[model samples]
Target chain A: MNIVVCLKQILDPLAPAREFRVDNEKKEAVRGAASLVTNIFCENAIETALQTKEKLGAAKITALTFGAADAEDSLRKALAMKADAATHVMNDGATNPDPLAVAQVLTAAIQKLGAFDLVLTGRESGDWGVGQTGALLAELLNTPYVGFVDSIESADGKLKLKRQTDNGFELVEATPPLVVSITNDEHNVPRIPKTRDVMMSVRTPITKFTLEDLGVDVATIRAGGDYYAVADLSIPVKDVQCEFVTGDSLEQKVEQLAQRILEVTRAL
Target chain B: MNNVIICLFASAGFDRATQGVAGAGRRLADALGGQLHAIMLGAFTATDEAALAAIADHVSVATELADYQPETCLAALTQLCQPLAPRAVLLSNDTYSQELAPRLAFRLGGSAVADGVELISHSEHLQVKRAVYGGKAVATIALKRNPAVVWLRARAFEPAAPRDVTANVEPAALTLTTNSATRIVERKSESAGEARLEDAQIIVSGGRGLGGPEPFEDLKALAATINAQVAASRAACDAGWCPPTWQVGQTGKKVAPGLYLAVAISGASQHLAGMSDSKVVAAINTDADAPIFKHCRFGIVEDYKKVVPLLREKLAAARQ
Candidate 1:
C-alpha cells in the first residue's frame, strides 16, 4: 500500500499569544520574531498513515508539503518518524496564500506524484483553521473525501474509517485512491523519533517542485492583495471586567466566586 | 426569485443549529436587499418546511439523500445556485459546512471565507469579520467574486425569531452522483445524553491542573448541578486524561456558550480561540497569573478540588 500525508509548517499554534503580531498594511501575519514548526494536527495525519502501515505490513509513506523552502524541516521530521519519502511544493515565502490557493497547489503537487492508494491531511491548519484543504483537494482530484477522521482500518481491500461528529462517531467505508482529513485522536498521537534516527533523517533526500513545475501560476494561488482585500486587522477589545475576589482563605474564594457568578447570571 | 441561498444540512428535521445559520443568512441577504432562499438535503418533514418558511422566502428540499454527504450536498447546492446567480451563499460552520463551503466556492468559481464572526456591508461590498493569530486579532475580509460562500461561526448571530409566513416548499432539482471513494457504514455515540459542547449553554472545562482523569468525575458532578457540559483543555486531552472529543482549543471544537467556567486551565491562546466568544467567562486556578485571568470576567485562586465542590454546593443552594 502507498500513502501520502500532507504536512504543513506553520507558526507554532502553541506560541505565546503575545508573540503573534499582524502587519495590517500587508494584511498578513508578521513572522519577524517567531519560529516555524510543524502544524500539530498535520503530524497526527502522518501518524495515522504510519499506524496504518504498521497494521498492514509492506507499506510506503510519503510526506508532502506546499510551503516555502524552509518546510523541508517538517518533511525531515516526518522522515525521521518513518515516512519513506518526502516532497516539497516550493512557494514564495513572502505572501500568505489563502486556503483555496493552498488547496490548488496541493492538488497540482499530488497530480505530479503519479498514483497513491490514500492521501491524508490535517483536519485544519493551526493558523487559519479554515479546514478546507482536504475537501478542495478531493474536489480538484475528483476523488472521495472524508473529514474529521479519527480512526482508520483496512478491511476486505477497502478502508474503514471512523469520523467524529458532534453527536457521536460515524463509521465510513471507502475504496483506495481517496482523501481523508485527519484530526488527532488518542490512538494516533505522533511518535517521537529516536535521537539516532533524528540525526540520520537530515541526510534523507527531498524532491522539490515549484508552482511552475506543477503547472500552477504563483500569482493565481496567492490571496488578499488583488483577489480580496483585508480592510483592517486590529486587536479586539474585551468587554467584560474581571473582578478578582480578595479572599485570603480557599473556602472564602470559592464562596465569593460562586456568589459573583450567581449575581451575574441572575440565578439568585 | 431569491439571489441569496443558505444551504442547511438537516436529517429527519432541520436541526436547531441550522436556525442560527438561517439567521445569519437572513441578516446578510436583508442587508444586501436581496431575496432570501434556503436549500436543504436530507429527510425533510413538514415541520422542517414550516421552520424554514418562517426564516426564508423559499425553501428547496432534496429528499433523495439518506445521510448528510458533502459531495452530494455540494452538487445540490451548486445546481441550486447556478440558476439564481446568487450574490452570496451562507452555511453554518459545522463539520459538514467546513467541508462543503470551500469546495462549493471552487465549483462556483468564487471565493470563500470560513468561520466568520460578523458580516457587514462596507462600501457596497460584503465584508467579513474573522479572528486571526489565535483570536488575538480581528481581520475584516472582502471577496472579489460573485456568490461568495461563507461559513458563519456557530452562535455568532442571533437566530431569526420565528414568525407566521407561508413559503413555497419546492423539490430541488439536483442530480447527485454517487462517489465510489467513500461511504458511511455505521454510527455510534461516544457518550449518549451528554450535553454537546457546541450547543451547551454553560461549559465546565478542566486542564492539566486536574492531574488525572479521575477528577473529571468530580468535574462531571459539578457540571450536572448547573446543567453544563464537561470539556477539557488540549493539555488534558494530549496527556490522555480525557477523550480528544472533549477537548476545547484551537485544534478542538470552537464553542461560544452563555457561560464558560475554566477549572485549572492556564488559558493558552489555542484554548482561548475556541471559547473567547463566550458571553461570560470565569476561571478557577491555583496560579493567579494564569493567562486565562486576562480573558475572563471572574477568577478565583484556589485548587479545583476545593473550589469545585463548594461551587456546586453554592449553586445548588442558590437554586433551591
Candidate 2:
C-alpha cells in the first residue's frame, strides 16, 4: 500500500490571542514572533497515515506539501516521524491562493506521483480553517472523499472509516484512490521523533516541484483568478465590556459572578 | 435566477440549526426580493415536510436519496438548481453541509464561502463576513458567480418561526447513479442525546486549568443548574481528559450562545475562535492574565475548583 499525506505549515495557532493581527491594507495576516509549525491537524493526519502503515506492515508513506520553500521544514518533520519520502510543491504563484487553486495544484502533484492507494489531509488548515481542499481535490481528481474522518481500517483496497458529525459518528466505506480529511483525536496524536532520526531526517534529500513542473500556469492559479473575492478585512470589535466580579474571597466571587450572569441574562 | 434555495438536512426531525438555516435563507431571499425554496434530501417525515412547508414558499424533497452522500446530493441539487438558476443556495454550517457546500458550488459553476456569520447585499453582489485567523478578525467576501453557495454559522440568525401559510410541495427531479463511489455503512452515536453545543442557549466550557477529567463532573453539575451545554478546549481534549466531541475551539464546533462561561481556560486564540461569537462571555481562571479575560465580558480571577461548585449552588439558589 502507498499513502500520500498532505501537510501545511501555518503560523502557530497556539500563540497568545494578542499576538495575532491582520494587515487590513495588505489583506493578509501580520507575521508574529510565533514560529511556523506544521498545522496540528495535519500532524494528526500524518499520524493517522503512520498508524495505517504500521497496521499494513508493507506500505510506503509520502509527506507532500505545497507552500513556500519554508514548507520543507514541515516535510522534514514528517520524515523524522518515519515517512518514506518528502515532496515539496513550491508555491510560485500568489502569496495566498484560495482553496480551489490549492486543490488544483495538489491534484497535479498527486497525478505526477503516479499511483497511490490513499490520500489524506487535515480536516482544515489552522490559518483559514476553510475545510475545502480535500473535497475539492476529490472532485478535480474524480475520486470519492470522506471528510472529518477520525478512524480508519483498511484491507484489500477497501477502507472502512468512522467519521465525526454534529450528531455523532458515522461508519462509512470507500475503495482505494480515495481522499480523506482527518481530524485530531486521541488515537492520532503525532509521535515525537528520536534525536537520531531527527538528525538523519534532516540529511535526507527532498523532492521539489514547481507549478510549471506540474503543468499548471501560475497566472490562472493565482489569488485574483478565482471566482471569490475578499472585499475587505477588519478586526472584529467587541462591544461588551468585562464586568469583573469584585470580591475579597473565592466564595464571594462565585456568588457575585452567578448573580451578575443571571441579572444580565434573566435566564432564571 | 433570483430564487434562493435552502438545502435542508433533516436528522431525527427539523432541529434548531435546521430552522436557523431556513431563517437565514429567507433573509437572503428577502434581500434579493426573490422567492425562497427548500430542497431536502434523505429521510424526512411528514411532520418535517409540513414544518418546512410552513416556512418556505416552495419545498422540494428528493425522495430517492438513501443517505446524505455528497455525490448524490450534488447530483440532485444540481438538477434542481440548473433549471431554477437560483441566485443563492444557503445551508447550515453542520458537518454534512460544510462538506457539500463547496462541491455543490463547483458543480454549479458558482462560488462558496463557509461559516459565514452575516450576509449583506450591496448593489448586485452578496457580501459575506466570516471569521479569519481564528476569530480575531473578520473578512467581508464577495462571490463573482451566480448561485453563490454558503454555509451560515449555526445560531448566527434566528430560526424562522413557522407561519400559517403552507408552501407548494414539489418533488425534485433527481438524476442519480447507483454506482456511487462512497456509501455510509452504519452510524453509531458517539455521545448519546446530550445537550448539543451548537443549539444550546448557554455554554459552559472547561480548559487545561481544570487539572483532570474528574473535575468535569463538577462542571457538569454546574451546567445542570443553568441548562448549559458542556464543552472543553483542545488542551483538555488532547490531554485525554475528555472526549473530543466536547472540544470547543478553532478545530471544534464554533458556538454562539446567550452566555458562555469559561472555567480554568487560559483563552488560547484557537479556543476563542469557537466561542468569541458568543453574545456574553465570562471567564473564571486562577491566572489573572489568562488570554480569555481580554475577550470575555466578565472575569472572576480565582481557582475554578472552588469557584465552580459555589457558582453552581448560587445559580441553583438564585433560580429558585
Candidate 3:
C-alpha cells in the first residue's frame, strides 16, 4: 500500500505581528518565533497514514505540499517527523490562494505521482480553517472518501471508518484507494521528534513541484481563475489603553479574576 | 420514522458542549417534523449513555474497549446506517464531523455536503445552505441523493431546546471484522481553555481601536465580571491578539448570544456578518460612526477603556 499525506502551509495562527504594506499583501501574522505546519489536524492525517504504512509492511509514505516559498518549511516539517519523501509545489507569493484551486493544483501533483492506495489530509487549514479543500479534492478526483476519522480498521480486505460529530460519534466503512481526512482531536497526541531524526529529516531530499511540473492550468490559477478571486488585504489599526486592576491585595486580585470569569459566564 | 440521524463525535473524554449540541439538534429535528437519532461509538459508560439519551430519540450506541477508535466506529456505522438510514444527517463542523460527513456519505452512497447552515427540503431532495469563500457568499447546495450527510459548523445554527420526549437507548456492538493499523501512541488535548469559545453565550470583543492587545485585558476583565466570552474583530484576530476561534464575523463564528458587548470593535461587513445576527448588541466605542454602532441595538459612543471598566465594576457589584 502506498500512502500520500497532503499538506498546506499556513500563516501560523499565532504568527508574529507584521504591518500590511500594500493593498495586495495579506495581513501579516505574528510568527511567534516558530513556524509550524498548517492546522494541527494534518498531524492526525500523517499519523494515520504512517500507521497504515507500518501495518501494510510493504507500504511507503509520501508527504506532499503546495504553497508559497515560506511553506517549504511545512514539507521540511513533514520530513523531520518521518515522511519517507517530501514534495513542495512552489507558487511564489501565492501564500494564500483560493483553497479549491489549491486542492485542484495538489490533485494534479497526485496524478503525476501515479497510483496510491490511500490519500489523507487534515479536516481544515488553520489560517482560514475553511475545511473545504479535502472534500473538494475528493470531488475533483471522484474517489471514495471519509473524514473526521477517529479510527480506521481493515481486515479481509475490508475497511471500517469512524467519524466524529458534535453530539456523539458516527461510523462508516469503505474499500481501498479511499481518501480520508482527520482532525487533530480525533486522534491522540502526535509524536515528538528525536533530535537526531529532526536534523536528518530536514536535510533529506524534498522534491520541488511547480506550475510547470504539476501542470497548473492558466485558466484555473491566474486572475479570473475558475474557483476564487483576489482582493486587497488590510491590516486593522490598533489602540491600547486600560486602567490597572486596582485590587488592594493579592487575595483581592484573585477574587477579582474569579469575579470576572463568573461575570462573563453569567451574562448568558 | 423519518428520522434525521444527527451524529456527533465522542472523543477520548467528554466535552461539555456535546450535550448542548445534541440538545440543539433534538430541537431542530423536532421542529422539522423529524426525530433526532443520536449515535455514539466509544467505550461506553453509564454516565455517557445517560447524557446521550437525554437529547436523542433513539440512541444507537456501540461501546468499545479502546478509546473511540476510528476504524471500529466507521465499521459500526456502515452496519448501523444500513438499518437506520435517515432523510438527512447533521453533525457539528468540529474536527470529527468534518471528517465523517463525507466518509459516511461515501459509504451510504449518498451526497455529502459539509458546513451547512440551513436544511431546506423539497420533493425528497434537500437544499442545504452553507457559507462559501470564507463567508463571502452563501451557496445553496442541492443534495444529490437521499440520506445525504450535511455537517453544520458548530455554533453557526442555534440548537433547539429539548422537548419532553423520552429517549430510547440501545447497546450496539460493531461487527469489526477488521483491525486498524494505526495505534494512537499518545493523545494530547489542546491546552484547556478557560472558556469554551464555541459554547459561550455572552461575548465581549475588542477591535483595532483597542490600540494594542494590552487593552483587551480590560475587555476580558469586563467580560469575566459579566460571565462572557471574549471575541474580536477580524483586525484584532488577524493582528494576532486573539485566537481565530474568538473571532466573530462572517468568516468566523456567527454568534447569537443573549448579549454581545462590543468594546472598540468596528463592525466591518465581514465582522458584522457574524455578529449582526446576535440577539442584542451593545457597542462602546469612541467613534459614533463605527459600523458596529449601526447594527447594535444599544450604542454608546464613549471610550471603551472608560466604559468597560465601569461596566465591569457595576457587574462585579451586582453579583455581590
Candidate 4:
C-alpha cells in the first residue's frame, strides 16, 4: 500500500489568548512570541498513517506538505514518526491561499509523485479552521473522500475505517485509491519521536519542489482571482464586562453565586 | 426567478440546526428577491415538511436515500441543482454538509465557504462572515462564482417564522449511482435521552484545574439541578478525565448556549472559540487573571471545589 499524508505547519494553538495577534493588512496571523509547530490534527493524521502502515505490515507512507521553508520541520517530525519519505512543495504564492488553491497545488504535486492508493489529511488546519481542503482535494483528484476518520484497519484487501459523526460512529469499508481526512482520537495520539530517530530524521534529505517546478501558476493563485476575495478581516471587539461575585467566606461566595445562577437560568 | 436553495439531509429528520439553515436561506432569498427552495434528502416527517413550507417557496424531497453516502448525495444534489442554477446554495454546518459543500460547489462551478455566521447578498455575489484564527478574528469572504455555496454555523441565526402561504412541494427526481467501492459496515449511535450540549440553554464546563474526573460528578450534579448539560475543556478531555464528546473547544464542538458556566477553566483561545457565541458567560476560577474572566459576564475568584457543592445545594433548593 502507498499512503501520502498531508501536513500543515501552524502557530501553536496552545499559546496564551492574549499573545495572539493578527496583521490586518496582510490578513494573516502576526507571529509574535508563539512558535510554529505541526498542526495537532496533522500529527493525528501522521499517527493514523503510521498505524495503518503498521497494520498492513509493508505499506510505504510519504509525508507531503505545501508550506514555506520552516514547514520542513513538520516533515522531519513525520519522518521521525516513521514516514518513508518526505516531499516539500514550497508555497511561494499567497501567505494564505484559499482551500481550492491549496488543493490545486497539492493535486499537481500528488500527480507528479505518481500512483498512490491513499491520501490522508488532517480534518482541518488549526490556523484557519476552514475544514475544506481535504474535500476539495478529493474533488480535484476525482477520488472518493471520507472525513473525520479516526482509525483504519486492513481487511480482505480493503480498508475498514472508523469515522466519527455528530451522533456516534460509523464503520466504513473502502477499496484502495481513497482520500480520508483524519480527526483526533485517543487511539491515534501522536507518538513522541526518540532522540536517535529525531537526529536521523533531521539528517535525511527531503525532496523539494516549488510551484513553478510543479507546473502550478503562483501568480494565478496569489492574485485571489475568481476565487473568493477577503472583503474584510478584523478582530471582533468583545464588550463583555465581568462582574466578580465576592463574599467574605467561601460559603457566602457560593450563596451569592447560586443567586446569580438562578437569575441567569430564570432569564433563560 | 433567481432562487436560493437550502440543501438538507434528514437522516435523523430536520433538526434545529437545519431549521436555522432554512432561516438563513430565507434571509438570503429575501435579500436577493428570490424564491427559497428546500431540497431534502432521506426520510422526513410531516412536521419537517410543514417546517420547510413555512419558510420555503418550493420544497423537493428525495426520500430514497437510505443513509448519508457522500458520493451518492453529492451526485443527487449535483443533478438536482444543475437546472435550478441557484443564486446561492445553503446548508447546515454538519458533518454531511461539510463534506458535501465543497465538492458540490466544485462540480457546479461555484465557490464554497464553510461555517458562515452571517450571509449578505449583493447585486452580483454573496458575502459570508466567518470566524478565522480560532475565533480571535472574523473574515468576510465575497464569493465571486455562480451559485455561491455556503454552510452556516448552527444556532447562528433564528429559525424562520412560519409563512401564511404553503410551499409547492414535489418529489426530487434523484439519480443515485452508489459507489460500490465504499460502504458502511456498521453504525453506532450514542444513546439518546440526555440533553445535548448544543441544545442546552445552560452548560457547566470544567477544565484542567478541576484536577481529575471526580469533580465532574459534582458538576453533573449541579447541572442536573438546572437541567444543564456538562462539558469540558480540551485539557480535561486530553487528561482522560472526561469523554472527548464532552469537550467544548475549537477542535471539539462549538456550542452557543443561553448561559455558559465555566468552572476551573483558564479559558484558552481554543476553548473560547467554541463557547464565545454564548449569550451569557460566567466562570469560577481561583486565578484572578484567568483569560476566561475577561470574556465572561460574571466571575467568581474561588476554588471550585469549595463553591460547587454548596452552589449545587442552593440551586437544588431554589428550584424546589
Better of 1 and 2 by TM-score: 2
Cα lDDT tens digits, model 4, A28-101, are: 88889999999888999999999988888898899999988999999999999989999999876677788888
DockQ of every candidate: 0.61, 0.66, 0.07, 0.74
Best by DockQ: 4
Pairs of colliding residues, candidate 4 = none
Write candidate 1's Cα lDDT for B1-320 as tens digits: 22788887665245445677888887777777887888876646767678788889888877775477655666767887888888889987677777778778878877788888888764645788888767878888787766678888777777887768767888888788866567777878776766456767788999989999999999888888777889999999889888777988787878887789999999989889988988788999889889999888888877888888888988888778
- lDDT, candidate 2, at B279: 77
Ranked by lDDT, the better of candidates 1 and 2 is 2
What are the per-residue Cα lDDT tens digits for candidate 4 across B72-105? 7788899998899898999876778888898999
Question: Could you tell me which residue pairs clash in candidate 2?
Answer: A242-B297
Give the top-scoring candidate (TM-score).
Answer: 4
Candidate with better lDDT, 2 vs 3: 2
Per-residue lDDT of A217 in model 1: 60
After superposition, the stretches of candidate 1 with alpha carbons farther than 4 Å from their true spots are A222-229, A247-252, B11-16, B43-49
Candidate 2 residue runs with Cα over 4 Å from true position: A248-252, B43-51, B161-164
Task: Give the poorly placed runs of model 4, Cα more than 4 Å off.
Answer: B12-14
Query: Judged by DockQ cut-offs, is candidate 3 incorrect, acceptable, medium or high?
Result: incorrect
